[model samples]
Target chain A: MSVKLKALTKSIWVFHLAASPCNNCDIEILDLLTPRFDIERFGMQLVGSVRHADAILVTGSMNRKARIRLKRVIEQAPKPCFVIALGNCACTGEMFAPSYNQMKPLDEVVPVDAYIAGCPPKPEAMIMGVVALIEATLAAAKK
Target chain B: MKGWGKMSDKATAKTTIIPIGPYHPLQEEPEFFKLHVQGERVVKLEIEIGYNHRGIERLAEDLTYDQVPFLVERICGICSCSHPFACVNAIEDVGGVEVPERAKYIRMFTGELERIHSHLLWLGLAGHFLGYNTVWMWAWKYREPVLDLFELMTGNRNHYAMFKPGGVRRDFYEEDFPRAARLLDDLLRPLIMFRDVALQDPVLQARTKGVGVLTREDCVELGALGPTARASNYCIDVRKDHPYAAYDKVDWDVVCTSNGDVFDKVVVRVLEMVESAKICKQCLEKLREVDDGIDCNLKEIPPGEGMGHHEAPRGEVFHYVRSDGTNRPVRYKVRAPSFMNVPTNNRACVGYTVSDATITLAAIDPCYCCTERTAVVDADSGKQIMTWKELLRLSRQKTERLLEKYNSRMDRIWT
Candidate 1:
C-alpha cells in the first residue's frame, strides 16, 4: 500500500495557470492531457486545484490579474513543488512583454524549476518537459 | 389622533434575495447577480460585472494593425482565429484590399476547422459540468483532428497566424492539400458518431431538455445573438445575414432550434459542426479548383474605423478597430459573443436548478478559464484569503449548496 502510494506521488500532477496568453498556449496545454501526447500515462494528471498538484504549469507572461493569481497558486502548492514555465510568453513575455498590462518572465513573479520553450511549445515537447519534471520530482523524493 | 390615523394608509413589503456571481461559474464573462425572488420566481435581478475584466479593449488601442491580430486573438482561444480573421478582414475591407482567392479559401478552411474544434470543445466542457466525463473525454479526443490539421497547415494550433491585412501570411502547396483532405475525411465518422450519441442519449436529454429555458421574448429583449439567439428560434446568423469572407461562396444551412433549452443549444452547436465539416469539404474542393498565388501583399492600411463580425462557434464575434495609417491601430474593441451573453445569466438560470444552471449557462458557449480569474476570499467579510486551496474548497461548497437548493426546488415544483 505504501509502495503504491509512493509511486503515485512520484508522478507529478500538474496544475496549469494562464496569464494574458494568446490561444496558442491554451491548446498546447490541452494537448498535454489528450491521448496522443498522453501526459497522464506517465501519471502526470492535470489537477483542478493547486493543493493537490506537485507542480504548477504556467503559460503566458504575468499580467496584472495573473500576477496576483500566480502568487496565490504558487503559495498554495504543497512543499517541494516544481514549476514548469511553458511557451515563450511565460519565459520572456514574447511580443506581448512591452504591452501595458503584461510583466516579464513568470520567474520574475514565482521561482520556476523548468522551462518549455516554443512560440507555443508543441504537444510532444510539452510531454517531454512534463516527463523531465516527473523524473526530477522522483529524484527529489529519493533524496 | 388625526395625525396617527393619517399615517396608517401605506404599507412596506419585503423581498427574497439571491446572489449569482463574483464567483459563480458562467459560460460568458464573469458577472454578479443579486435577484429578488418570491417563491421560485424572480421579481428583480441586480447585476454586477467587470470582476473578470483584464481590459483587453483598452490594451488593443496601443497595438499596431499587424500586432493587433495576435493581441485580439488572445480574447478567446476557442475562437482564436475568428478574432484575428475579423480584425484583418475589417482592416482589409476598410483599406479596399482583396485577399488572394487562395487565401480566402484557406481562411474559409481554417475558420471551419475552428468551428469544428471550438464546438467540440464546448461539448466537452458542457459534458464535464453535467458529471459526464466520458463525453468530455470522447469529444476532446475527436477534436484533436482539427487541432492536428491546424498544426499541419499553419504550424501551430489555436492561433493559426495565417491572416494578414490583404491575405494570409501562409499558403498551402499541392502536396499539403491531399494530406489535409485525407485527415479530414478520416475524422468525419468519429464526429458524426459522437454527434449521434450526444443527441440520442436519454440521460443527456433529461439533464438538458427544458432546463435553463429562454423564451423568444426573453432573447430579443436581452439582445442575445448567435446560437443563444438562434436556440430561441431566431433565424439570425452573421454569416447568412452579413455574409463576409467566403461565407457568400460556401453552401450551408444555419442550424437552429425552437426549444431554447440546454439540449437545443447543444444540438445547434453539434449540427453546426456538421455544417462546418461540409464547408471544409467545399473549401477543399474550391482549393483544388483554384491556382496558387501570393497569400498576402504587405500593403499600407489607411487610418479608419471598421466594424467586422464573424460567426464564432459560440456566436457572433464583432471586432471594431481604428487604424492611424501608420501601421498601428489607435482604438480596438472586441465584442465576443460570450461577453454579450454574460448578462443573460439571471434570465437563463433563474427558475432552473443551480446544477442545471451550470449546464444551461455553459450551453450558451461560454469561454471559462480565458475570461475569468480566481481569487481566495473570506465568505463572511469578503476579505482576501491566504490559501487558494481553502478558497477552492469554499467555492465548491457554495456551488454544492446552490445545486441542492435548485434540486429541491425542482422536486417541489414537479412532484
Candidate 2:
C-alpha cells in the first residue's frame, strides 16, 4: 500500500540452470549467494523452482543432456522471462563445439535477453547483468 | 543389453529397490538410481540418468577450437583451468607450437590455484552434506583469499581464461608478483586452520569416516584417480605421473591416503591444498626470477591426433584432439574427471544403507547433472527426444517462481 513498493519493481528473480556445466560455474553461482557476493542485496536469488523466476540464468554450453533438462526448465518458465547467458560456453559452444558431446550456444536453444561475457563472469558482473535486465524491463514498462 | 538376467541364480534372489538421487538431502545435483537390495545390502543396481542433459557434447562439435577453451572451462568452474589447459595443450601438441617458458609457469600457477580453490570448495560442500555447517561456513570464509588471488591474476574469481594455445594470454608484471605472494601467504594460514579442523572434527569424522568406502582394490578395479582414488592408497597424480606444464620443476608431494572413505578423501584434499599452496609459493618465486618472454605464441595446427591428460581437482582429465591444420579441430574428446568417478558410484554405494549411499555418492564428487544433460535416447528404441517444449515449461515455472520469491509476483494488483 506504500510507494516504497514501486522501488522494488525493478528487482528480478533468477533461476540458475546448470545445463551440463562443468560444476565450476554451478559452484560459483552458489557462491554468489554466500555473503561475499550476495545477490540478495540487489533483490536477486537462485530460486529452487522455475515456477517463481523472472529471468533464467543459464551456464555451460548446451549438451545433449543439458539441452533436454534446460529445455524442460525453459519451458517451465513464464513468458517474457529474461534469459542471461553466464559464460562464453553458454554464449557459444567454446572449446567443446568440435566435440561430439556438447551443444552450441544456449541462444540457439533458448531465447536469451542478455549476455554476460566471462568464462564464468564474476558474481559482481552477474549481479550487474541482472540489474541491467531489470532496468531494461522497467524501461519497457514505461514505454 | 544386460538386464536383470545378470543377477546371481540363488534361492533368495529377492532384491529390494531403493531410489537414489533426483534430489537427495545431501546432494546438490540430481541423478536417479534403482538399487536392488537383498536383506541389508545392495545386490544390484540399475542407474537411470537423463535428469540434467543439455547436449554439451553435441554442442562442442559446432564451436571453433579457439572458442572451445572458454566453453570447456565452463564445463566445471572449480576446475576451469584444467579443461582449457587440457584442450589447449592438445591443440598446441597437434599444432606443434612452442609455448614460452614464462607462460609455462603461469599455466602451472593457474592450474595449482584451481586445485586449491576446488579442494576448498569440495571441503565446504562435504561439510555441508555432513551437517557440519560450521566447517562449511568457515571453509568458504577462508576460500575468499584464494578467490581474491584469482581476481587479482585474472580479474575474475572463476573462469580465468589465462591460458592460450602456444603459451598463455596473461602475463604477470613485477609488481603483481608481491601481491600474489601476499595473497598466497594469507591463503596458507587459513588453509592450515581449516585442515586441522576438518581432520579433528568429530561430526565430520562420524558422517564421512566409514561412509563411501572404496578399498584400494575397488579403486584400481574401477579406475579411479585424483583424490577420490588417492584416498584409497592409489598414489596416482597426473601431475606427478605425467608431469604436465611446469609440475616437473615444482617441488611438492602427492598427498595420498590409505582408507578410501569420505573422511579420507577430505583429508587428501585438505593436505593437497597445502601442497598446492607450497607449489604456488614456488611458482611465485619462479615468476619473480623468470625473465621476460611470451606467454603464448599462436601457430597453425597440423593434421594429427594426440592425447593429453592433466590431473583435475576431481581426477585425471583426459582430452584427445585431432587437427587438420584448420582453426577448428576435426575432432575433440573430453574425458571429464566426473566421467571416471560416476562409474565408481556403485562401488561406494553398494552394501551401504540408503543414507550412507547418498553421502557416499556425494563423496565421489560426481557431477550428475552435467553427466545426464545429453545423450537422451530411449532405452528400448534408442530414439532421440526433442527437449524444446519441456525446457520451455521448466523455464516458465522457474521464471514465475523467481518473480514470487523476489516479491515481484506479477504486480498487476500493485496499483
Candidate 3:
C-alpha cells in the first residue's frame, strides 16, 4: 500500500450527513462514540465540518429537500473522501424507496466505498464495516 | 418554509440573525432555528421544522392496518414503542378487540423499558451539551444495559416490531421473568447513582437551575406535554390521565417538580427513569402470575375512528386512526411530543443567552437530529460574521466560564 493511503487508515474523521433518516442509524452512529463502543480507539472521530472530514458517513434515504444539500456536502469534501452508507435507508433507500419525496440510494447519489446494512446496523457491525473499508482502500492503493 | 420569511421582520441594525440548523452539529434531527440576537442574548426565536418530515402519515394510508404499526415504529427511533403502542391501542379501540391480560403487561413492560433507555439517551446528550463529557459517557454506558434488555426481550434493539392491533406480537414467557427481573435490578443501582450525582453536583445545578424557566401558564398555553409540562408542575401524563395498557394495574408515581427550570426537567426525567424501572420490575413479576396464551387474535378492523395516546419518553404520543371497514386505515395521524415541545421554545428562549438557550432548548429533550451549521448575519451590513463552528465554540466557552464560576464559588465557601 502507498504510504499516503496507509496514513489515511490511521485516523479517519467522519462527517455525518443525514438525509431524512428514521434516526435509528443516526443514534447508533452516536452510540459508537460512547465509552462502551469507543470507535475513537480506532482513531475514528466525528468532525463538525465536511471540509475537515476524510470520510463521510451518510445515513437515511436521500429525500427531496436533503438531496441538494447532500450533493453539496459531498462535493465540498476534499478529494479522496470515502463515503460510507451507514444504514438500510442510506444503502438501498429501504422503505423510503417507493416514496415520492425520496430520490435514490446513497450509491446512486454518490460513490459508496463501504455499505453497512441493518435497519440500524449494530455498533459492532458499523466498526467492522469501517475496518473493511480501510482494508479495501489499502488493497486498491497497493495495485 | 412558513416561518423562514417572517424572520426578516425582526432583523434590525444591532440585531444579528443567527440561523441554527437546517443541518447543524448540535442537533440529532434536522430542524431550523432562526435566532434574532440582540448582543449575546436571544431576543426572539423562530423555529421551522418539516425538514425531517418523511410523509409517514400519508404512507400509512396505503399500508394495511396490520402494517401501520411497523410504519409508525420508524417515526422516531427513540420513541419507537410509543407510536406502535398508540397505533395498536387505536386499532383495538376501533375494532373492539380485547387484548389478553398478559399482553397488556408485556406491552407496558416494553414501553417503560423504552422510556428508561430514551430518558438515559437524553441525559447523555444533555451532559454533552453542558460540556460534561464524563456525564455523557457515563449516561450512555448506563443506557447500554437498557438497550441490551430491549434486545433480549424483543429480538431487536430499537424497533421491537412487537406491537399488534389487539395485543403484542411476542409474549414474555413465565420462565424468562427471573432473568429479566435480575437485569432490571442491576439497572437500578446505576440509575440511582446518576440521580444522586445530578441532584448533588453543584456544577450541573449551576448550569441547569433557573436557566430555562417555562412556567406552568406558558406550558399550558403552548400545549406542552410529558416531562416538559411535568417539570413546570402542569401534571399531565397520558399513562396517568388516560391509563392505557397495563399502567392502570401498576403502581407508580408521575415524577413532577414545581420549578420550570432546566434542572427540574433533568430531575423529572432522572426520577422518572427510577419510576419506570419500578414499573418494569412490577410488570415482570405480574408476567409470572398470568397464564400464557395467544398474544393477539385481531382479524379485522371495522369502520370507525379511534384515538389512542401513550406517554412516550419525550411526552404524549397521540395516534388517530380512521378505519373504513377495510384492511388499510383511511387516515392516520401521529403527534410526537417534540411537535408540541419544539414550539414552546418560542416562549422559553426569549430572555436567555445563546449558551443558556442551547441547554434550555435541549431541556425539553428534543427528539430530532443534531444541529450542524449555524450562521450569524449582521442585519445592517447584510454580512455574515460568525460561522457554525464559531457559534458552537462560543456556546462551549460560555459553559466553561459558568463551570469555572460555580467551581470557584464552591471553593470559597469551603475554605
| Model 1 docking category | acceptable
Q: Write the per-residue lDDT of candidate 3 for residues B321-341, one digit (tens) a residue.
A: 876677998677676787678
TM-score of each: 0.81, 0.78, 0.89
lDDT of 1 at B350: 77
In model 1, residue pairs whose N, Cα or C atoms come closer than 3 Å (at least 3 residues apart or on different chains), thus clashing, are B27-B366, B64-B328
Report lDDT (Cα) of residue B348, candidate 3: 83
lDDT of 1 by residue, B245-270 (tens): 88889899998789998888888888
**Model 2 stretches astray by more than 4 angstroms:** A1-15, A39-119, A129-143, B1-31, B35-45, B50-68, B95-98, B295-298, B368-376, B379-415
Error (Å) of candidate 3 at residue B193 is 1.3
> How large an RMSD does model 2 have?
12.7
The DockQ-derived docking category for candidate 2 is acceptable
lDDT of 3 by residue, A38-123 (tens): 99987889988889899999888766667767888899998778999988888898776787566677788788889999988999
**Candidate 1, residues A1-143: lDDT per residue as tens digits?**
23433464566787766655554676667666766666777677777667887777777656665566568768988866778788887777766666655645688778888899986787887877766766665666675
lDDT of 2 at A50: 71
DockQ of each: 0.24, 0.24, 0.46
lDDT of 3: 0.82
Q: Predictions ranked by lDDT, top down?
A: 3, 2, 1
